[model samples]
Target: MDAIVLLRDGLAAALTPGNLLWAFCGVLLGTAVGVLPGMGSAMAVALLLPVTFQMDPTSAFILFAGVYYGGMFGGATTSILLNTPGQASSIATTYEGHRMALGGRAPQALGTAVIGSFVASIIGTLVVALFAPTMVDFALKFGPGEYFALTVFSFVAVAAVVSGSVLRGVASLLIGLAIGLVGIDGQSGAPRFDFGSPVLLDGIDIVIVTVGLLALGEVLHVAARGRNAPDLASIRAGKPWLKRRDVRRSLPAWLRGTALGTAFGPIPGSGAEIPTFLSLGAERRLAKRREQRGGGESEFGKGAIEGVAGPEAANNGSAAGSLVPLLGLGLPTSATAAIMLAAFQQYGLQPGPVLFERNGDLVWTLLASLLIGSVLLLVINLPFAPLWARLLKLPKPYLYAGITLFSVLAVYAINASVVHLVMLIGVALLAFVMRHFGVPVAPALIGVVLGPIAESELRRALAASAGDLSILVDSGISLTLYALVLIAAFIPLVSRVRRLRAERRERETTGAGTS
Candidate 1:
């Protein structure tokens, strides 16, 4: 009942004309960025962060929520129409989605993707609203040791599980940690990496780092690709309208994908990509089983509406699900969520249990705004998906130039500092190098956001226990988190070993045949 009352109040606040306008603008901008290859919600939000510095926090968050959900909706458009996934999470959608488009069922594939995204977003946001408080209640029990353990788990999971190469992921994370260490030591007010520069003492601003790494770095990387960039000249998106039979086939898949996404979303390091792939695999298996049972013919390789529906739903659901941890535990599970965390810090707000107590209305209002964003996403994206795809029609050089302009302006906007601009260039160069080396940047961003927090908690824990190392695992909660960390770290190595062995066996079999 209390939750209901709060939601109602939030609805009232979110319904304000100003907030609604921001939501509309955010979704529009988010969809545009998502339609463009290599640009995601994280980059959009990071670029916009400086613009929102003076705006009301509530309104800024509403805009961000809209952009976050809108990116999910827009990613499927390119995947279905062009076989090019705008975001990593949309990679699963491309398998059946492009095939569907090739089979002249592009409209049905797109329709299912949009509607499935809608269904998943609505259900997923509701789950967050209902369960976020409970998560906060659970988080209230966390001491410094437990928090440190949680950070450790996040670090290992992101560095080990998210990256294809664990070594590269760890390297990226160390780079971020090193960047985070540039400021003064919070514990003793001692400078660590200032190098006798006044600007260095203030530390690298999150805004500069995000804009440089995401927006500017992406531009540089894309520019380096030059003529090799993915061509969008052959893109075609017809009207996306589903037949009754298509709807019937997609509904169940939508539900199933939503369930999987919601289940895995809150787990740190498990991004939308995991749930989306799982949904794809599940849909593939279900179709096979249905065929075997004489229920229907399986469309495993061909364009299946179920395939597009399930993965798209899972993508959006997981996107929404990531918010649960971000809102309740102050943990960011995805790149966008990590940037959102930086936004929270910019507003002098922390997104944990204390947030609900101190700014309960803002929290509820943000949740309500997310609901509004989801609905707006459906309304705007359903009919305009093709138009969004045409965003690729814009010349690449011009698009990159604009991004470069914004990157510089966004950094310059931060207290109008030239030193920050230099730092942005350095970070952008670093980001390009990381991208060139195939290192995952998300883990690095996560390390930048969480490294200081983890250090502070660990230091506090040690201080409390008089430098005893065992204090880090004294509590059941802390021990459980560390245990999960070990499991998370170990699983990747095991998988790698299996993969290598399978490759070796394949080589031997191929050699025998050749001989």
Candidate 2:
């Protein structure tokens, strides 16, 4: 009842004409930047931080909330249509989303992604509003050991589920780990693979890696295919609306993804990447089960609607989930949240238990603004999804040329360093070779993302326990995560063995009948 009263007051405050206009501007600006590779919500907020200094706190927060949600929505647009992810969180969507676009289901993919993001954003914000304190308590329980276990779980789940072959997946993951190890060691302050260059000491940026591997690599790969390359412009986009059948298929996936995102979002350092990939793995497994029962065909390797829906939902939900810790504990789980934290400090407001007591109205108003932002995002983006898909209709030469230009600009924009451009070319070549050999690039990307986190957490746990191995599993959270890892790894092996046995039995029966 108290919550209801506070929300009512918040809505009354947030629905003002000035606040509504700010929300619209924020979402509009956010979507524009998010559609560009390497430019995400964090950059958008960072750029606008100074402009907000003159604005009221409530209006400023409302604008930031709009940008945060809008970025999530825009990231999916490119990942589905162009095979380029606007940010790391959208990478999971690219695995199946691009394939769906190639199969001429671009409109459906975009539709599912938009609806799923909207659903997740609304639910995730409400979850934050109603359960922020409880979620903060839960997040505080994680130690280094638990964090290590969580990374391991993510590794095994993505490797086993995303790859067609386990060996290839492991190889790609190792390549990523090696790339992640290029900079100076954080613990020892010693260079590992700097190659005698000052630029190498700082390590390769994630933006460079993502753009090189997904965007530039794709351009090179297509160029290598010569005239025989598939013509994307020829692919006919069907109706611009999601059919009832598509919605029915996507609704369950959206809910499951939202649940996963909400559950993992509050954990510091977990980020949207883990939950988005986990959601993809879960949907893949469920599709396989449904196919085995003769209920439906699994379209995982092709472009399944569930794949786009689940991961996109998870990405937005995790974005919303990260706010729980940010508001209640004053902890930033992501880059954008970190900037927002600075914004809070600039306003002389400290977030914690006292925050709710001291500025209860402001907190509720912020949450209400998030809800309003979500509605604006859907209204602004849904009508134009089909128009976004029409981007593929451009001539291949122009399309590829545009991609190359953006790829170069994205890398050069990092620090205006020529060495990064050289590294981008190198990474693109590596990606091209991997693609030629049918090696999955997703695992490598995951490794680059989670490898350092895993290593840091493992070392922290060991250092804390004075080199005691038992300390890693001493906590219930760590133990449970390891158990989940075992189950995830074991299930695939069991299925492979059962299938081999069935094949052998069938062969022997055929031989006996022939005799």
Candidate 3:
């Protein structure tokens, strides 16, 4: 009865002409932003944060959420058509998407990407609706140590070694940790690397960090490659249609990916990023084995519908999984969720255990809105993909210059501080340098966002225990967790050395052949 009430209320709220318009406008703008190279959903959301100021909070958040959903959908447009993933989530799509485009089946590929993403998103939203109650119950029981353990578990569970090599992946995680350590210390509240800059006192904003590292850093890297005035010829899909074989092959893969992706969703930091990669790797290996047995690796690389299906499901599943901490404990796992967290805070609403009691309608309504958005995305995106794909062809200078202008202006608008604009530029430069060194920027952003909370929690845990060291090891759960962290933190180094050895062997063979 309560759920029904909330659904009715939420539907009423979401379906209001004003809210519906915002949702539609959000999706359209988000899709266009995401389809453009260097203009990811994160950057788009960050850039537009200022625009939401004049809007009602409820309508604003609905729009933001719509933008997030639309951005993910739009990411595949460029990845398939141009071998360029609009964002990180679409990287795996590029492996198969570009191939499908090359085969003169661009329409079919776009259809699979959109349809698969839509179905996966719907399933994921349903999973959230059905499972959130149980997850909240489970998460409410977590102590600080348990939460810490969950974070470690997230990093370990999502390791690429499970899909590719474990060591290299672990290294990427450590890089994130190191980046998280920049700025002020959470517990002591002292600046770490402020370098005498007053703007560093408040610590790095997650939005700035992500925008700086992914967008600004990418721009610098691309500029370094001297591809300054690149021209694009749009790819076309004539009569896009999925064949019976495509359907048969993709359904199983979609189901498999959803199951696999959902299972890995709740381990703290684990999300679609790793799960998609792992799913793709699994599909590739399975396809190879099947080929060796005379089935032939038909769709594995050439936009095999399965390739599109698995990663899409994994990404959506991960998004649903990410809500676990946000609702259960007020922890935001992904950058998008972090931005949502800020939105929640703006309305003086805190998300956590009490959220259900205080704003059950809002919470349920939010969940219901997710389902609505998923359906809307599938309906809109599937038919207009070629149009979406052309969004990638927008002039880079105009787009990037506009982004640069907006990022600074947004930062200033938020605080009305000249210092913030300076801070944004500084981060942009730091992010660019960080990328030149091959460092993964996501962890750093996660670190900056999570660092303060983790520190605060650690201190609270100690104060509650009256500073006894035993508190850290008091529970079997904590001991087990620490041991797991130790294992995860070291695995990447070991994996890297192993990979180097394999490469060396191949190199030696080539050198000997030349001799």
- Count of backbone clashes for each model? 0, 0, 4
- Stretches off by above 4 angstroms in model 1 are 1-117, 128-133, 238-370, 503-515
What's the lDDT for all of these models? 0.80, 0.88, 0.66
> Which lDDT tens digits does candidate 3 get at residues 454-511?
6565677778788865776777766776786677556556767887999999999999
Local error of candidate 3 at residue 177 (angstroms): 3.0
Candidates sorted on TM-score, descending: 2, 3, 1
* TM-score of decoy 2: 0.96
For residue 78, what is the lDDT in candidate 3? 65
Off by over 4 Å in 2: 512-515
Per-residue C-alpha lDDT of model 1 across residues 173-245, encoded as one tens digit per residue: 8988888898899999999899999889989987677666666777788779888855544445567778788
What TM-score should be assigned to candidate 1?
0.67
Give per-residue CA lDDT, model 2, range 396-479, as digits (tens).
889889878877897898889999999999999999999899887888888888899999999999999999999889989989
- lDDT for model 2: 0.88
> Which runs of model 3 end up more than 4 angstroms from their true locations?
1-23, 29-65, 75-110, 153-175, 227-240, 244-249, 256-308, 321-366, 392-515
Ranking by lDDT: 2, 1, 3
lDDT of 2 at 369: 88
